[model samples]
Target: MSAQLPKIFITGATGLVGSALVTELLAKGHHLRALVRTSSAQLPGSVEQVVGELGQPVDLSDSQVVIHAAARVHVMQETTSDPLVEFRAVNVDATLALARQAIAAGVRRFVYISSIKVNGEGTEQGKPFKTNDVPAPADPYGISKMEAEQGLMALAKESDMEVVIIRPVLVYGPGVKANFRSMMNWLNKGIPLPLGRIDNKRSLVALDNLVDLIVTCAQHPAAANQTFLVSDGEDLSTTELLTRMSKALDRPARLLPVPAGLLELSGKLLGKDAVMQRLCGSLQVDISHTRDTLGWVPPVSVDSALRKTADHFLSTL
Candidate 1:
């Protein structure tokens, strides 16, 4: 990177990944221009926030690189009555619109943060997902992401802007919500989870590790016109993960040797089979290409990351 850092524009500056990204970019001495909604709060001092919506025309005239990280994530269900129409508004239409504006503004690079769901819900037995695998998005969210990727690729071919797409699995760290919070809750309550007997491997990325990878992609020449699946480069089963969390929390992990089949059957009966599968099923990613290409490795180990997350949780309590 040059001493005079490039002017970078980021969307969804307040989001989970986006917020961390903003901090990382600032630390690297990059000038930041963040696109935010009217209702959004002020960002960090380093970022210049531009109030705008996805549907509105974006002004990227001064930006050297654009990172599209904004989306209507978890707003609507994929099985909704008209998911395509709903998702296309932000995920496809708005994203493509922004890309077009970026190109016209002479932005040299565009990095898109996508999801591993684009590869499908589950992985093959004992095999992690790779970048070369064919896309088989199972839900509307995944389908929309795939469409956005394709659109960006086509635009890249037509314009001078370089495009890089990243598909990251289960990212966790401080300020996390939903599943991460639930896991913490379980550990706090000392509940003996039924996952003790399961040994299904799942891939996860820590926020710091993921942010490092994203920043590296933004500047690395090798990242242009490439797609990568990112993780912590370590796979862990639910039981193992819980154990680590327990260790981090300095608490005994209360776990039962329950059978996976029984747990699945109970979850199905309770109308939570999908949730159960996600918790117990194996979903791994192969990041060898990322290492060999960009010469990037995860900065934080899983143990340290988990401990930090646990410490954060403990602090709040």
Candidate 2:
């Protein structure tokens, strides 16, 4: 941090990651211009809001850095007829469009917040995903993100604007929703869960950790044109995660030692195959490059992050 911070233009300011990044940057006295869909979008008082949509023309007059955090995230039950096309429209097409605008506006750096899905869904034990792994995007959302990363890298080669891609695994923290919240509810209710015997490891990134990496790339010269995977650097199994969450909530973990095969079968019978696979799958990432490159490490431990999440969840009750 310097006496004068660079002006940053960021998208998805109201999102989980974006909002956290904004708060962090603002606290550091950085000027931020956020692209929002509406002028009335809720944001901090000092954040300059530019009412606009992605893939559309935007003014980047004096911005020195652009952080692309907005995308059409994966949906559990896709309602669209053509999901890939829809994902491409926002994640790929719009992302490159904005990068081109940043180039034209002479922005110095572009940091893309990508997903680990760019490296495929799950991994085997003792084999984690690295930055150099061949792209094996599984679904429409992952495909779109991979395409966007390619487009950005290509554009970076042709311009002076530096590009840094960060792929983060499951990110959890205060205000988290979906499965994490559901699991918390289940634990809080002292319901028995049949996930005790599952032996799988999954890496997760706390909001503080991911935001720290993003900010590091914003100005770090070594981050230029490099892709990094980030996590808590500690992997956990489904049972471990539930047990830890229960500890945070001060509830006894009522876990039944169900067989993994039986759980998968039950999932298939209930049309929750994907859910079960996620719960029992191992998806780990190697952040050694991130550490060796920028000398960065996760600032928050898993337990600390879980406690923060639990505290927030309890406060809402």
**CA lDDT, candidate 2, residue 79:** 96
TM-score of each: 0.96, 0.98
- Over 1-317, each residue of candidate 1 has an lDDT whose tens digit, in order, gives 64577789999889889988988888888999998876455577657878888858878888999998988675523567887677778899999999999988899999999899889898855898899899999877888999999999999999899999999999899877888878988987898787888878999999999999989889899999999889998899888999999999899999898988888898999999888888778899999999999999999999999998888888887
Off by over 4 Å in 1: 1-3, 39-42, 75-80
By lDDT, who's the top model here? 2
Scored against the true structure, residue 264 in model 1 reaches a CA lDDT of: 87
Candidate 1 TM-score versus the reference = 0.96
Name the best candidate (by TM-score): 2
- CA lDDT of every candidate: 0.88, 0.94
